[model samples]
Target chain A: MPENKDYLNYIDRTAPKSPLLKNALLAFLIGGLICVIGQLIGDFYQKICGLETDSMRTAVSVTMVFLGALLTGLDLYPKIAKHAGAGTIVPITGFANAITSPAMEFKREGLVLGMSAKMFVVAGPVLVYGISSSVVVGIIYFLYKVLIGG
Target chain B: MATRLGNQTIALDKSVSIINTATVVGTKESEGPLSPFFDVKMKDAEWGEETWEKTESKMQKEAAKLAIQKSGKTADDIDCAFAGDLLNQCISSGFSARELGIPYYGLYGACSTMIESLSLGALAIDGGGMDTALAVASSHFCTAERQYRNPLEYGGQRPPTAQWTVTGAAAAVLENGGAGPYVTHVTSGKVVDFGVIDQNNMGGAMAPAAIDTLCAHFSDTGRSPESYDLILTGDLGRIGREIVINMMNSSGYNMNDNYGDSGCMIYDIEKQDVHAGGSGCGCIAVTACGYIFRQLKDGKLNNVLILGTGALLSPTSSLQGESVPGIAHAITLSNKPGGEG
Candidate 1:
């Protein structure tokens, strides 16, 4: 019998490659569209809502997150993501979907153990890394400031 | 007495016939190429069930009932049932068996459960342990997605190598004596892992096992690829099917002309968005019970060899970075009884 590694190599040689260029192009366009929508929302908050810059940014994020969760609830985001690939994943809206999708799926398991616990099933690692990296960066900044007197 | 052939194959002495079979599939499969061959096609995936798990159980139950009904046998007449599904605890088969109320053997052979059950059921009758038995296997796309890959509404991209889990169930009634379409031989497979870890490319992981079993069946029975009218692999999608053909050719067995795959035949790959093709336990079960069984009954096919391929990977195993081990069980169905030719 052939070694497992050799078999894996054979499979790798024979398996069809994913259409990387097409996927990348689709992701770029769709991700760009999402960013443009976020920018438009920010502008709306700035011009019409009469909000401060910081408050406007928060409002824009909130609106975008709401839209993402709504689309996920309506069962439309997954269909879009099927074609959009990382285009849906790179945006903050994707993060919202990550949380909402599990919540909706696990709802049958009940609210506490099912919905609440599994809500972060997909996004849990994101939050963990995101917060951990921020803390590490904060420590580095603190050390640099103290030692260098900046 | 069923005599053991070379190493892996067992040639049954008595006739063990697949009296009847029934298949139930979801709307997506109903729209597929083999739609006309199925016994029941659900209007929707949900089928008025509150959960996908429940829907799968319901499909299995309906299929089992239909199979028994078609065979002119009642539930009480069946001595036992062998059933399985691609759920966390094999809950779909368990629930269906509970409703069926026959002496049950709940199996977990991943996608190979269909043939695994059939092989066991035929063996029991051949061994005189049972007179009549039912073999059932089911899988629902929604249930499998949530259990194995992701939630139904999750927005994630699947690779082109990924297969669509078939939403269907199939049941076959096997009796100790019948006129034709007999289970003449069985070659049980060993778990063979090629160290493939990609969960998306299940076909790649499963192809080696199918090849192993097919080779064993041929050597044990002293048969060649041309001995059978069709040599079908269960749920080895296009890529896996290609791999099998290449590997078999290198092994000095030419199966290019007679070889077919249930996964590729289940759906129209060009039109259907199923990238690799249909998969899961239901892929083979429905194809065999619906299309192949009909063809065999209509005299279009005389002798057929079916190898049900399964990638034995669980969510926990995949998460732990374990390689996917594969297995395939081969069953030979012939119009003539064993030892005739």
Candidate 2:
């Protein structure tokens, strides 16, 4: 936009650009590492709760949503977002990571009052969409199950 | 060594003391760079040479005036000068020195320019590089913003990773022939990196780098943390200060006795409008080159370990999702001398 204007063009455009191949590889490595952490959490839940792997799947899914919500509050999602870019951000992991970062960051004020209340300052809209869409999906599943009842 | 300008002669043995220090920020009438794209309308001009230079020159000019007053150095007799600033062409320091018309040199290191310049200046005085050296740093809120972010009037929300660049400048002048609290030693710092790519929160991004450089400076010179009266960092702000404290604590070297930061020094947050705190080349430069230099001259602080921190960020990588690497350099300034004062 500044064209050839020297001092007028004060924009910082010198950050290094990683190749797509390198970015993808970095995303894969970091994303896989995060998945390993998820597997560990799921396995731990199963061993402690005595739930079968199939039943644990539901718990894990719910836990993931909660975890995504929590991490989102922690403000850590940005860091992970930076490392894994859209790969981690597109998944529920980004949601949890996002909420938890801001939540935990502001938790010093008081968990319930500060974190729980206003933690969704930036992500409230996305969380609302995520929940509403899930509600609709649940209703459709219920209707299908009722029609196909044994 | 022989002197072309004669040995730096101390006009006054107890010369140069800090009498007073103050800084002023500009008004909203001075905000621009990203207004067009960010605001779709021109809110104001924040990044022009007029605005940036105004603040930058005002700061350095005031700082030099103060330094000259505190040091008790007559302006007419200040032989050659060693100076530095953060601008690409070293505008603020250049302007200040040019306005005064004393021989000067331009230096840069992002935010570390002050300390880096000071360290070199101390050595210049000690090793007879010049009669007096003044180190300085200044950044406009708009210019620094446009370079690092969208722009102030862009009205875009900023992440917590952001740091407010205070539109101020700081300067210090070290005389080659001043009092004994004059710069005794100035050790060089290595440019080391810790591979931190996320430049969003520069404090966390640059702590490891600062620690690495500090550690190297100490190790290279066979000195310990306890050897200095104060170990200060330039422009790390609050979070970076915490990280540095944590790193130092983990390393089992407590610097709390006299440890401080230039970022934490600017503006009284409770009273002033500085959001998180100061973070610029000028923050530390103003304090050390302005306040601390006087204190050092007055024997208030006998020794100081000034480590200036910097985040190696260009606008391109931040936009492209690359991590920000960081660097810091440490310089030791003490009054102890090989020759008798």
Candidate 3:
């Protein structure tokens, strides 16, 4: 018998794993399925509402995102996320889920603590950046307008 | 760069023993402090916090007693406590530490609390700061389900990919001296954000974290895939485990050997009606404390690597449309012969 013995006798020594294809396919197929909802929204926003293409695009995107986020907060998104994988979350739905959950959770903390203060818990930084960048672009456009005498 | 444990010709085997371990959870407190969540959810019929605290606390105490009994050590001999729970403020662990009356160190690695606390406790012992340490973590079905997804009684259909959070907890006692395997190495997880944005089913979100950290562990240790006897993952369940294997295999590494997952073992999803599998610290901790630890004591496994993966997302964050990010922690356990007592 060997003087030095190995203590572990039944380690399930096997091979490395790969999970990308299944998940990727899940992402693609389910993700594509969710896009049908977006297409309908686009059509509704354009043909039904008769809104301008660019403005309608933004509005529909924002709405889809908001509803996606709201449903996510209500714990509906994970169910969709499970089947769709990346499909449901890749669109405006995931964004909406991310932005609103904080507000909903904090709503009870009081207006200042919950509603007003909670909106920024996770999404605050992104919101700040978006606003500041938009303002900067507006200022730059105005400066260029003055320079070009437009 | 196989950093063999002291093969310098003069190093004797280190036999590390487990002395004591304990756990605490919010599910047991009845009505002491955590009535707010239940009070609010009562209106929605998805109330969960009511029974969550009691369950968590019961799990903690039971696991602690089991660990202490297994190690042949008493609670007073425990020098420090390492604990984590799926709670906002780690109430499960905090309350346990307060009740058990030991110096405590609270840690969070999401579902990775098992490995996280073990790694910390092992370090505390290995660094010569303490003799015995306990690591524990827990999650309650009612509280976690309600907070993360819907109300307890909401009765919504879960997607096939979603996993069940096991109402679970586990405890492991780490001693400075004894027999068997010791904590040899650890690898911290890297945030593997593939820009995939889905926060609902956190198992899917965290599969990447498991792969990233497991692969990173292999890389950091400079060891090949065949080095360890066991490589375990926490709470990714069937879907997450499949994805992890797929991702790793695609990367020129196959994880078919010595690989089992915590989420897969905790419960029979068919019998239990769990859609996917089990998640939470208890998933890993309980499995290790029970079956896995027995195997170690029985000499079925020599070395093992346990990786606990956690998706770093809160209920509010997921609801806000933010992409879920995740983390994993890896702890290595190896056995050796008895030392000079």
Candidate 4:
């Protein structure tokens, strides 16, 4: 039998490498574009609605999420994501797509069992880690204030 | 009597011919270079089915029916069928068999299923177990994507090594006797894992198995690269094809001129945006039943070796961080029943 370690090394050396520079550039531009759009929406909420800072942030997020879900439903997000890579994924819109895609795909299986149950298949991991990390950080901050500040 | 050559190769005493074949492909495949060769091409992926899975089954059924019809026989004339697909439980082949009402042997060799069915069907014919048998395999892009990767509408970027599953089906009618393009030798491969864990780089994972099988076929048959007019591998994509060529060259066999891959042949990589190239059971199935069969019948090619490569990994296995194991079964198709052309 051929040596597994040697075989793997050969494969790694021979296989074509992904264009890291091109992907990073695309991700930056697309991600910047989405954030710019979000900024514009935030500006509108601040100037026109005269909302508070916290309320404006919420409004901007809601608007962005709506747009993401709408784009996903129209089947245009995936096309963009194909080229955008992490640009589309690192944003809130990516989370929306993650949730909406499975929901759309599993609608055939029924609303509760298919759509609702499978909706978090992709986004679930992100949510679990994100929330758990936040909680840990919160506990650390609480302990720091209680000990150091006291 | 069928004699075992060396370790894995089998030489059938009686002749088993692929009397006829039919290929049915979806829109993307129909737009490929081999578009004109396929028997039936659907205008859309749906093919009037409610779901992608049903569409795959329909394609399989249509291909099977057309193959039987082209062979000048009915479903009743065929004794049994060896069929499979890249779906959970092999549902596509099972549904197609249900419609055809042929005694079914459903297989799951991942992408290697087409040639797996072909090899077994040829054996059945050569063993005098049945006068006629059907070998069919199918895979739909949407079905495979949802099952193996992500949802159809999921917004995710595929890596460069990722392969697009071909949306199509192909069926061959194998009989105990026929004019030409006979199944002469069968080399069933062993599962070889080089500990490749990346699911996207399926070609890398399957290349070792393809290399192992090819080397065995050459040693057992006492033939070299020049023995066959063409050596076609099933769905190894462009990368896998290159690796096989390089490894085989290092092993003292030069396959530079006569080698081809079904994955690279099914789609125009530049135009189709298929990343590495086409994959899945339908990749080799359509290429063999449509393009290779045509070339052999027209006397343009005499001998060809088809190696069906498959990465045997499930979503569960990938999630559990298990390495992907691969297998490749080689079948030699020649214009002459025995001896060199």
Highest TM-score: give the candidate number: 1
Chain B TM for prediction 3: 0.83
Candidate 4 ranges beyond 4 A from true positions: A1-3, A143-150, B339-341
Predictions in order: chain A TM-score: 0.94, 0.54, 0.62, 0.94
Model 2 per-residue lDDT at B58: 57
Interface RMSD measured for model 1: 2.3
Q: Which of 1 and 2 is the better model by lDDT?
A: 1
Better of 1 and 2 by TM-score: 1
Encode model 2's per-residue lDDT on A1-150: one tens digit a residue. Answer: 112233112112222233567668867887787678778778987998788998887777778778666545454555456557656755566666555554654454577986687567546879799899999999999999899874
lDDT (Cα, 0-100) at A13 in candidate 3: 20
Q: After superposition, how far is residue A134 of candidate 2 from its true place, in Å?
A: 30
In the predicted model 1, the residue pairs found to clash are none
The worst-scoring run of ten residues by lDDT in candidate 2 chain B lies at B33-42
lDDT of 4 by residue, A1-150 (tens): 344998889888987788989999999999999999999999999998899999999999899899899999999999999889999999999999999999999888899999999999999999999999999999999999999995
Cα displacement (Å) at residue B227, model 1: 0.5
TM-score of 2: 0.56
Between candidates 2 and 4, the one scoring higher on DockQ is 4
lDDT tens digits, residue span A1-150, model 3 = 121112111011211232567767877886786678778888899998999999888987887777776676667776666556666656667556555655565555577875677565555666789899999999999999999878
Across B181-285, the per-residue lDDT of candidate 1 in tens digits comes to 999999999999888989889999999999999999989998999999999999989999999999999999998999999999999987989999999999999
- Tens digits of per-residue lDDT, candidate 2, B1-341, equal 42121121111222222222333234321231211111111123332434545556656666666556655665664555555655556777777787776667777777777667666665555555456655556665655764565322221223343566755555565665544554443444444444445555677667767877666655545567778778888777766777777677878767667778767665553344344456777566555654565567578877777877776667776767656566676665566642122
Listed per candidate, the RMSD to the true structure in angstroms reads 1.3, 16.7, 11.8, 1.5
